[model samples]
Target: MPSSNKNLSVSVIIPVHNGGESFRRCLSSIAAAVPPPHEVIVVADGDTDGSWCVAQEYYTTVLRIPVCSGPAQARNLGARTATGDILFFVDADVTIYPDTIRQVAIAFSCEPEVAAMIGSYDDAPGAKNFLSQYKNLLHHYVHQTACEEASTFWGACGAIRREVFFAVGGFDNRYRRPTIEDIELGYRLKQAGYTIKLCKSLQVKHLKHWGVISLLRADFFYRALPWTELILRDRQPLNDLNLQLLSRLSVISIFALLGAAIASLWWTALLGGVVVFSGVLLVLNAPVYSFFVRQRGWWFALRVIPWHWLYYFYCGLAYAIGTSRHYWRQKKQLAFGN
Candidate 1:
């Protein structure tokens, strides 16, 4: 339980823009949660969707950024205006569960060395579709387990001491694009020798609205751009198993196309190989899919599988393109002054 003292306060910063039903749900959940924030700061970024008015109904501390400054900027602005010792930055679409704030407070109290703590999101229960399942699996692989050498924390439901946040100069506004701001900020914090802990008790319910086209666009912007940035900064070759799969896929695709133009027998052999490779990818992802199906049932799984494969293909392609572009741009910039 949080102490009744007003001095030990927490400010929840929610950045919003055109968030429809999700925004309302997000706010309600926060309000419902135990140990409510001392103040809920909602940064409305040029929202023409009446999201600001909706927020006004619930929160008194609202800042409307004149233009659409993106989430990182909005979050920074909120942080600057927050009066709390701890800043809880959450997305407008997430619905945090009860006891989340209490858990975060307890974690910090227990571990004085921990600079920050991140919570888990409730992956949609009936989200059996391929893309949804893959996304959930990917998230689980990266975060569900604790890290002894903790580096990055998810931005969705993360808390940081005001002093630590200022020390790192907040998030880099240069990453104004869709989804990498969190990862980039986390990277910077790690570089500055701050410990980020993943707390299982602090949970948020994430409502993913993923379709085929949405998944593709997400791959291009979210997954691809950040990955490319990481590769550029780290200067490490893509040695992950996912990258290896993409390489194998690309090779098979090349041979299959070449054989089609040359001989019928070779074409048949290449086609068979491609089918086998596709089957292997599906099989590799089956355990995760099965888990989703068991949780959500078969109907959701059928819809999610194809979407997942499409996401995988596009994500791989986007990463390849983004990384190439980053390298080319860097080389060009170095060669030319402007």
Candidate 2:
């Protein structure tokens, strides 16, 4: 029987690897949340830091993998053991609000047709560093502004009905790393005609600190490349958060901006192309900059511009590379049948 709004049970599943202090705070929040979850399942994905032992302090169900499997496998393990109507997936480095679980329950109960829903990070991140703040805040702004009818799912603070989750085959275990596993699962759910919503009000606080090198590495290899390949593989619609129309325009403009700057050395007239494309970029992304300004004033927004542009540049490069690689593999398979 479909659970009623008042009686919906939530099982909070957290996957951690070397959780450290953030894990403590994550568990602490879960322990303190009013109307506590029906159960808390912590999956330690090969934690040598004794995060699994620490999880025992909270009196929640803890599962441990001998070696580090990716979060997708860890989450799948936790989901298999969860006994609640709603399987709430929270990252180890993120802390949820006191009413997060309650809100998930009410949302599902009220809308029986909602198979899954994902939430955004709060505007105020736990880390105060520039990159950390910019990255996390960018995430918050994007989710806050995105369509309510979501195209992809987020693992940071996402929930799915237990039955619906398994019906779509859960997180693809083939994703052995921390990449776009959640997004892939969301795509599959939608393909199966399941409804996934972006629940903006159900927010969580992100606690991970981001360094520039780490940010670049994660964005290019772990994120952009894999996601681009996934989109081409599934022929996805570019209607999701980062794949929106404005972002595509921005990517094209950045490449054009680069082309003009490079071509200007031989022909001075092409220098005008650089200025033109720059203006196009600024106009295209004015809303984002304005949102950043509203969130953290002019100085912070100014700092975010270059970093944001660099992000688009790399995304464009990744798309080109991934597209080439995907087709090459397709051609190889057709010929070699491997």
Candidate 3:
């Protein structure tokens, strides 16, 4: 139970780049929260789109970085200036629910052991495109169903105890982009024996639109590669969060089936392999497809299935390249040292 005398205050930190209307909407949502945060810090990381001006429109403290520093650095700067006991990190493209801050405070109050916690995007994404829906909804489903004792943290709507965050050195500035910074911080917290929880009940609406190519590129380069590097350096088990045993096995099966399909000389065998891979992919992602069907209609789910399969294929390839590169770099460095 929370101590009667200690009131935990929250400081909401938002990192902005070039977002325009989305940034405005995000600030509006934060302002409208029932119990507003103790402070709202908007760190402008070289915004040429006049987003900093929009920040000035709200009752927010704006930190202007003339150079285009990434979200990681921007967030760290915000954390440094935050006066609250809890630091809430919200992205510039997400709209929070009115109860988000209250729920976060309650979470910290109720569970003194939890060092950090993350929430997911709601099913109703603000983007109307099909690719946007597929990407955003898939994220929502995974985060909602993930283990409560999560292995990683998300920057979309994650909060950390202010002191604990500083103790773990906050977000690693090496991640100049939005990729894997929060997860890296989570790994450090776990290494220091702190618990991070996934609160699915607290949700935000994502405003960013994702194209198919951009999504694939982000999956491969930004996420898979960086995440693989982090795991390699930390030497952590891959059985946590999204990389559970069943999910790995599914990725393996899909890869093997696809490889066979590509290498087969006979057209009939190639066709058979494609059929087998499709079956396995469908089986592995049945629950995800069902979730989509419920959120949208069956027709939307059917339309998205092919692209999802392609997504898995590319992600598997990315994992392969990332792991191989990690090992090769380690070997090269060791050889040079010797």
Candidate 4:
């Protein structure tokens, strides 16, 4: 559907923290989008890398937070100062397609019942590498089949009615860290009887720049901790089947390597065969991994595959630790009635 001629004002809120070169590109893309946002709000969270200055050059309204708070807090701060009817939240690392704003506006206008809408990067072509492919496949598999009542919306390109955002009290500032605040907020919105629509047409190009170690560190600190907090607070079991599959894969791979090592003590050929077979299995799964890697090229795939497995392991371990800590803290709080 084409964009309506009616003026649908939208405030684009971008939270930045040492965003560097990517922030400028993100702003440029947003500016290029049709029916541009009424205003762009960049909430700079104690950016020491001169990101705030760069954002100021691109965005007219820049809100600077002295202390480096997480994106959740930064977004809330931006929303507080925004003057538009609709709030479009975009991560500094993501660039929206030219028609994104129009598509988002159309989706909201067409569906009065949808309190918010989420756009995916999976629609973009050329994400072919083992890691990128796997990432893309995961994105498509999870989101393409996502129910309207999903527990979380992708934070990269999500929009919500200003009223609905305020009604839900914005993102929970309690999350103080850069993690699953989006997921928690989505859960809250659903609890309040609001539906979130997934807009496949509103595509954003995500420049995911993570080598293996960096990715693992990110998962441990950002993703895992926030997820743990959410599961504990809501008492929701870790029921995501994908998590189970990862666990199984990690276990199987570890055992397979150990067996191969043991076999090698007696016969070098057996060990070599095991190693080759493992490599072949990973290669066979290359198509699945290509969805994530296609954007970075062959060099990234060569460097990232080994690290990805370790990253997943660290993520799982961190999640377990975080979950345990959360449960203990909750129990203590309940017992003391503080």
- Which structure is stronger by TM-score: 3 or 4? 3
Cα lDDT listed for each candidate: 0.71, 0.94, 0.88, 0.72
Better of 1 and 2 by TM-score: 2
- lDDT of model number 2: 0.94
Candidate 4 TM-score, C-alpha based? 0.76
Pick the TM-score winner. 2
Model 3 lowest lDDT segment of ten = 1-10
Model 1, 80-197: lDDT tens digits are 9998878999988778878877776666666778888787666552255566555655555335544533566567888998889999999777756557787777777877889887
Pitting candidate 2 against candidate 4, the one with the higher TM-score is 2
Instruction: Give the residue spans of candidate 2 off by over 4 A.
Output: 1-6
lDDT of 2 by residue, 1-338 (tens): 27554588999999999999999999999998989999999999999999999999999999999999899999999999999989999999999888888899999999888899999999999999999999999999899999999988889899999999998899998998889999999999899998999999999999999998999999999999999999999998567799999999999999999999999999999999999999999999999999999999999999999999999999999999999999999999999974
Better of 3 and 4 by lDDT: 3
Locate the minimum summed-lDDT window of 10 residues in model 2: 1-10
Expressed as tens digits, the lDDT of each residue in 104-147 for candidate 3 is 99889888888899999999999999999988998888888888
Model 1 segments more than 4 A misplaced: 1-8, 125-142, 145-150, 236-266
Work out candidate 2's RMSD over C-alphas. 1.2
- lDDT by residue (196-243, candidate 4, tens digit) is 777655667766564446555667787876676776677765333234
lDDT of 2 at 253: 99
